[model samples]
Structures are given as C-alpha cells and as structure tokens.
Target: MANLLDQLKSYTTVVSDTGDINSIKKYKPTDATTNPSLIAAAAQMPEYQSIVDDCLLAARKQLGTAATDEQVAAAAFKSLAVAFGKKILEIVPGRVSTEVDARLSFDTEGTLAAARDIIAQYNAAGITNDHVLVKVASTWEGIKAAEILEKEGIHCNLTLLFGLHQAIACAEAKVTLISPFVGRILDWYKKDTGKDYHGAEDPGVESVTEIFYYYKHFGYKTQVMGASFRNTGEITELAGCDLLTIAPKLLEELQTTEGTLPLKLDASKAAAMNIDKIPMDKATFDAMHEKNRMAKDKLQEGIDGFSKALVDLEALLAKRVAELNVAV
Candidate 1:
C-alpha cells in the first residue's frame, strides 16, 4: 500500500504546515503554511540560521544604524517569511500561506498594510499570488481586510477559525480559503471536560466537518482548509475537505501508515442536507460569538499566544542587531 500522504492526496489536497524546508521536502505536501510561531521555531534551527542572518543584514542595510528594535524586528520577520516561502516553493508545487502579524488581528488597516508588505516581499522575490496565500486571523476586521485583498487578486487563508459564525463571515466576505482549526477545538474541549476524546466523535473533527458541510450546503465558494491538527485521527477524519494543512510531525506519522483511508466528507452529500443558509451581520455575528463560549475563549487565547511569540521574536532580532552593530 502507498503512504497515507498519497492516499490523502486522492481525496484532498495535503498542505505542509511548517516553516522547515526539510520537512516540506520530506513529505512533499501540495501546499505549505507558516506563522510567527513556526517561523520563530525555524529561526532557531542551525540550518535556518543563514536565513536569519540574511534577514538581519537586509534590515541593517535598509533601516540603517538608527533603526529602532521594533523596525528591525519587522524587517527580519518579512525577510524570514520570504526566505521560507522561497524554499518551500522549491519543494511543493503549490501555494504557501504566509501570515501577517497576529497583533494586527483587530486592526483592519494594520493587517492590510502588513499583508501588502508581505506580498510585496514575495513579489520582489519573484513569487506571485498564484503560489502565495496571505494568512490572517478570522476576526471580523481580518475577514473584511481579506475581502479587499482578494479583490486585488491576492488570495487569503483565514486562520484561527472556530465557530460557524466565523466560517459564515469568511464566506460572506468571499475569502479565497478558510482554515477551520481542528486540533485547537479538540484541545479546548479536552481541557474543558478534562477527558480525552476518542475516534470520530472528537470535537475538532466534528467542527471542521460541520463547517465543510455548511460551506458546501450553501454553495459558498470559500474553500475550507482544515488546520491546526493534533493527530492523524483528526486529519483522517477530515479527509475529503478542500485542503488540510498538517504539521511536520503529523505528516510524518501519516506517511508511515499504509491502509484504507475512508472518505468522511462529500460536497454533494453536504449539499443535500436540509439546512437553511443564514446571513451573518454584525449584530448576529456578535450574538453568536457571545453564545459560543469555546470560540470566544479560543480566539482570545490564540491571539494572545501569537502576540507573545511575536514579542519573543522581536527580542531575538534585537539581540541579533546588537551583535551586528558590535561587528560593524
């Protein structure tokens, strides 16, 4: 039997969710995704150190000696995103989703500016939107920003998504794709109930399945890309999704398995479901978000974690700048 990766490809597009090039080369996912946390982790790796150094050098050249720590850090991040995207593109024949600063989750203007900067960097490096998807948080502001970006021919991948409201919002905005987080939902439920979920009944799996069905049922053009997977079980459960972004570890785990992978989601079947499509306005979206305690808490937590990681990355870049100054 072929590897699980190959099997999954038959049903859904497999995306590598890492900033590590070696992992992408190993699993050869059809697409790839990167965030601040993943890029920070990759920066610490010896193999990726050169990319950091290059970024630092570029920052110094552009910002000059008087650039503030925050400016230097931002430049380094943009450089790292571009570098990782270039390397990943060499291995994967499909698109890569590079995220904006999580700190800009609620700031539509800031998110748009950062997104434009990221895309500009990619374009300078000769990568087009055809192979790039700017990843943004699925907040109301972020979704609206994505709507504008999509019109400009720059596709988006809405990440940190949880509830049906978020999905509906993304579809309404006409985002190119939405990554409903599967593993994080599982984590939330496990922590809330203090029990391990098993098999197909997992909350994460259920969440993505429901979102996938709704998108298909309503003829929403927004692609459902399941992400933040915790295990192969959750991934396999969402096999027939538009796309699934898997971490390096999970991708490796899937590559080792060689058995029958069953199909769990079908768009045609989903379209046949007896469900009415509901439009989500500001008032409705707010009410739904307030009702879903899980979504509310998880969204805040995700934002906080990403913000903290961004701070840590900035500190690392500051240290690098200090060292570079001493050398100069």
Candidate 2:
C-alpha cells in the first residue's frame, strides 16, 4: 500500500506551501506557492543569501549607479520573487504561484499593474504566464484585478479566502484558482469557541468543503485549493479538493503515515447535494462579506500580516544592497 501522501496525490494535486527550496525538493509537490511571509523567511536564511545578493547586483546594473535606494530595493524585491519562482519551476513540473504586493489588496488598478509587472518579469526570464499563478488577496478590488487579468490571459490564484462571499466572487470573476485557508479558519474558531476540532468537525475543513460543494454544485470553473492546514487530519478531511497546498511538516507526516485516505468531498457528490446558488453581485457580495465578522477580520489580518512581511523583506533587501555597496 502507498503512503498517505501518495494516496492523497491520487485524488488531488498536492502543492508545497513553503518558499523553502529544500522542502519543495523533499516533498516533490506538483505545484508550489510563496507569500510575503514565506519569502521573507527565506530571504533571511544563509541558503537564500545568494538569491538576494544576485537580485541586488542585477538591480544595480539595471537601475544604474544613480538609482535611489528605494528604487534599488523595489527592483530587488521584484527580482527576488521571480528568482524564487524560476528556481521553483526548475523543481516542480506544475505552476508556481507568486503573489502580488499585499499593500495593493484594496486598489484594483494598482493590483493589476503589479500583477502584470510580475508576469512580465517571469516572461522576461522565459517563463510563460501560464506557468505562473499571480496570487492576490481576496478583497473585492483584488478580485476585480484578477478578473481583468484573467481576461488578458494571466492566471490568478486568489488567496486569504475565508468565506463564501470571497469564494463566490472569485468564481464569478473566473480566477484560475482560489486558496480557501483551512487552518486559519480553524484557528479563529478554536480561539473564539474554545473547542479543539478534528477531521470533519473542523471548521476549516467544513469551510473548504462548503466552498468545494458550492463551486461544484454551481458548475463554476474556478478550482478550489485548501491551504494553511494545522494538522494532517484537516488534509485528510479535504481529500477530494481540487488541490491542497501543504507545508513541508504536514507533507512529511503524510509521507510517513500509511493509511487509507478516503475521498471526503467529491464534485460528483457535490453536484447532487441540493445547495443554494449564492448571489455574487457587488452589493450582495459586499454585504455578505461584511456581515461575516470572522472573514472580515481575518481578511484584514491576512493582508496586514502579508504587508508587514513584504515590508520586512524590503528592509532586508535594502540592508543587503547597502552592505554590498559599502563593500564595493
């Protein structure tokens, strides 16, 4: 019998949710994803120091000696992200998800420009937009940006998704994929209600299951990828999701544990479940999302957290660039 990881792979695409190259190599995920936090963590590591330094050097050559420190840092950050994406592509046969700037989560045009810019960088490096998933926060503005980008042939992965409102919006917008965070939802519920959850009873698992059913029941083309898992049980519970981006620790657990992982959420079953079709018009969507206090708070928190991570990366890059200049 195959390990749990191989069994899960038989049902869904397993994506490595970390920015660490070693973890990606270890798990051998079909797809890989990186966010501000993960990328920032990698930037601080000695293993990734060459990636940072190379990006800074190239940024200097492109921006010239007179470029401002801000300009160099900005260019370096963008390069660092694509550099990681390129490296991940070398390992994974499937796509790599690189995120848009989190600070632009609320600005539609800004998000579009940033998304296009990232894709352009990937294209410049000979990777097509089809191979890259531009990750954006699931805010209305971010969804709108994705909608526009999708039309232009750039695929998007909507992240920080917490509620039906966000999921419906992404589906209606025709995004390539939506990552409904399972563990984060569980975290919120466990803290709010003081109950430890497992398997089908887990709120995070329930959320993703609801989203999977909703998307399937309505015949939406957008794929649902459950993410941010706190335990192996949550992953097992979402067995039939379109994809699941798991961190390396959980991947290791799944690899070592041998068991029969059942298909818990099937599209065929979902299609026959008699669920209500959600109205995703702008006003209705806004109201529903606002009413879901957990979703609203967590969405803001995710954006803020990613924003801080990006800022931290920027600071780290700026410091590295300064040190290199001093050495020169």
Candidate 3:
C-alpha cells in the first residue's frame, strides 16, 4: 500500500512549508514556501551558514566598506529570502514562494518595491518570475500590490488569510495563490471557544474546506493552498485541496502511515453547490475585515510575528558581520 503522503500528493500538490532545504529534498514536495521566520530559522543552521555569509558579503560589496554592520544586515535581509528561494527552487519542480518583509504588510508601496527587488534578485540569478510566487500578507494593501504585480506578469501568494473576504479579494485580484492557515485558525478557535476540535470538525480544516469550495464554486483562478497545519487529521481532512503546504513533521508522519487518502473536496460538487458570492473591493474588504475578528487579529499577529523574525535575522547578520570584522 502506498503511504498517505504519496496518496495525498496524487490528488493535491503538496508544498513544503519550511526553509530547511534537506527537508524539501526528503519530502520531495512539488513546491516549497518560506517566510521570514523560516528563513531566520534556517539561517542559524550550521549547514546554511555559507549561504548567509555569501548574502552578507554581497550586500557589503554593494554598499562599499563605509557601510555599517547594520546597513549590511538590512541589505542582506532582502537578499537572504531570495537566496533561500533559489536553493529551494533547485529542488522543487514547481515554483518556490519567497515572501516580502512582513513589516511592509500594511505598506502596499513598500511591499511592491520589496517584491520587485526580490524578483529582480531571482532574475539576476537566472530564475524567472514563473519559478517564483512572491508571497505577501493578505492585507488589503498586500492584495492590491499583488494585483498590480500579477498584471506585470509577476505571480503572488497571499498568506495569513483567515476570512472569506480575504479569499474573495485575492480571487478578485487574480493573484496566483492564497495560503489559508489551517492550524492557526484552529489555534484561535481552540483558545477562544475552549473546545477541542477533531478531524473534519477542526475549525482550521473547516475553514480551508469552505475556502476550497468557494474558490472552485465561484470559478476563481486563484489557487488555494491550505497551510500551517497542526495535525495529520487536519491534513487528511483537507485531502483534495488545490494544494497544501505542510510542515516537515506532518510530512514525515504521512510518509510512514499507510492509508487510503480520500478526495475530500471536489471542485465539481463545489461548483454545483449554492454558495453566495460577495462583491469585493477596498470598501468591502475593509468592512468584512473589520467584522471578522479572527481574520483581523490573526492577520495582525501573523504580520507582527513575521516582522519580529525578520528583525531577529537582521540582528543576527549584523552580529555576524561584526564578529567577522568584514571589510569591503
């Protein structure tokens, strides 16, 4: 009998949700994703030290010897993500998701500039936009920026999404992908309601299921990738999603477990179901965002978390530059 991982991959494209290149190789996901936190985590690994040093050296070279450690770190922070994406792209057959700095989540212009800069780095490395999905938070500004990037032939993956409104907005924007966090949503519900969820009953699983149905039913081209899973149950429950970016641990569990992974979500059934469509724009997005407390809180929290991780990475690089006494 084939393992669950192989079965799941048969119906849904499995994406690795970490920056660890070895894990990507081990699990062999079609696509891989990385955010500031994952990149920071990977940067600390001894195996990845050379990658970090090279990015810092390149940044220092660009800025000249007069650049402070702080300046060098900031520049390297921008390059580090694309650097990791480049490595992951070497392994994954499909596109790799490299995120914009989370601090720019609310700044559409900053996000746009950062995304363009990331894409430019990849381009310089001989990787085109087709091989990458510039990931951004699902803020209205982020979605708007992605909408423009899409028009320019650059693809985007809108992350930290928790509400139907955000999903609708991304679909309307025609962004290439949307990563609805399944585990985080479950965490919020478990904390707020004080009830343990099981399998299909899991709030996180239900959330992504609704999103998968909504996207297929509405004929949205934007792909839904269920991400940040907490358990194998949530994973198996969302068996037939368009994609599911899973953690290495869960991937390992699925790889060893033998079971028939059923196709839980079907596009044809979703298309036939009666699901109301909401008109999405800046105003509607804002209103719906304001109304959905879970989405608003989680979006802000996810941004803050990712922003802090970026800050920590910058500091680590700064310290490295100082320790090495890097000059020119």
**Candidate 1 residue pairs that clash:** none
Better of 1 and 2 by lDDT: 2
Best by lDDT: 2
Among all windows of 10 consecutive residues in model 3, the one with the lowest summed lDDT is 319-328
Using Cα atoms with residue i matched to residue i, what is each candidate's TM-score against the true structure?
A: 0.96, 0.98, 0.98
Q: Is candidate 1 or candidate 3 better by TM-score?
A: 3
Q: Mind giving the per-residue lDDT tens digits that candidate 2 earns over 3-56?
A: 999999999999999989999999999999999999999988899899889999
Model 2: lowest-lDDT 10 consecutive positions: 270-279
lDDT of 1 at 60: 77
Q: Per-residue lDDT for 72-160 in model 1, tens only?
A: 87778667777888888888899998888999999999999989988998898888889999999988999999999999988999999
lDDT of 3 by residue, 1-328 (tens): 9999999988999999999999999999999999889999999999999999998888889999899989988888889988899999989999999999889999999999999998999999999889999999999999999999999999999999999899999999999999999999999998999999998899888888898898898888999999999899999998889999999999999999997889898888986799888888789899998998888899999999998998898899999988767443
Candidate 2 residue spans exceeding 4 A from truth: none
Candidates 1 and 2: which is better by TM-score? Answer: 2
How many residue pairs clash in each candidate at the backbone level? 0, 0, 0
Error of model 2, residue 10, in angstroms: 0.1
In candidate 1 the C-alpha lDDT for residue 298 amounts to: 94
